[model samples]
Target: MAYVGTFSPNHSLLFSGTKHSLQYPASTRRGVVVVVRAESMTTEKLGIKIEKNPPEEKLTQLGVRKWPKWGCPPSNFPWTYEAKETCYLLEGKVKVTPSGSDESVEIGAGDLVVFPKGMSCTWDVSVGVDKHYNFE
Candidate 1:
């Protein structure tokens, strides 16, 4: 049987479609756009979230304000995060590979990345690095 349901803003299931077909309400007081995807909708899963080559307008909408900046010269180093980290790259290129894994992610300017807490990774800053980061 096909599972159908509506989720609230907090992602809790509000209702399910069984005998009746499911449909979204024509009007909603909330202006936010909601996207619902079934499990394993995408193939890639590397524990890193990236918004690649995002447009300036979308970045602005994400509240990309001037943040405390950090920079480093071209280098390679192993690192581990004590807490979750989110960063918006301002400039440079980087490759991050998870511990005991050969697979790596290429990151550059205009890329938004989230590194999970307690993740052990190696950072390869190829073209130097400059970015704004926040930890949670």
Candidate 2:
């Protein structure tokens, strides 16, 4: 069976067939692992989570089409999220760099992105943006 999960610095979790293994340092308490059988997996960059080209069914489940749309031309600005935000990009490209972080997360058309609550970041919109966004 296929599994989808993410890795942290202290633990390594791997799955094959029906068996799974967790390898962690001795000092830390055991952590929980959540796995999903998905056609696509999510990835993290610059503390932001992104699911590239997520399955169509997943979009439907999120009711992405019903979310409010926001757009902007090429510009750079700092933003802080008071609540968790999830957005589906319908067009354009953006690079978001978290506060004090040099690395940036690049997101574009067809990407599902999640920004954690209280996150402070800079948004550099390079190709304009047309997206449906929801705050949770």
Candidate 3:
């Protein structure tokens, strides 16, 4: 059996089948909060990831500590990330489909998402979007 475990505040493991890999960590030592990306075998190619149901406090703290809050009315548009973007959704829903791929991921309220740089994706806003975003 495979398992994923957190070793410290700064480290985590990625396990698939019988193999294990060490994932990159964002240090929690400097009195700062950071969100680290988790890579799994199946979802690795999308270049966009949504964290697995972050705690309410974590989501609230991210909004309070982030910049440039945005709201978009219900609509659809194609957007390309010029730089790495990490966003926490406070309300609304959206489906992002990468260009040339049939797979899509739905993002909604209380979700923390990371979109990598140069990723070409179309945004399908289903219930509008309200979120706090920051580019890395």
The model with the greatest TM-score is: 2
Candidate structures ordered by lDDT, highest first: 2, 1, 3
RMSD of each: 11.5, 11.6, 11.6
TM-score of 1: 0.62
Model 3 poorest ten-residue lDDT run: 12-21
Q: For each candidate, give its TM-score against the true structure.
A: 0.62, 0.70, 0.62
Question: Which candidate model has the greater TM-score, 2 or 3?
Answer: 2
lDDT (Cα) of model 3: 0.71
Off by over 4 Å in 3: 1-45, 56-65
**Which lDDT tens digits does candidate 1 get at residues 24-130?**
45354235343343332112237988876556665567666555778899999999999998788889999999998989988888777888999999999999898
Candidate 2, superposed: residue stretches over 4 Å from native: 1-39
**Model 3 vs. true fold: TM:** 0.62
Off by more than 4 A, model 1: 1-45
**Comparing 1 and 2 on TM-score, the stronger one:** 2
The Cα error of candidate 3 at residue 40, in Å, is 16
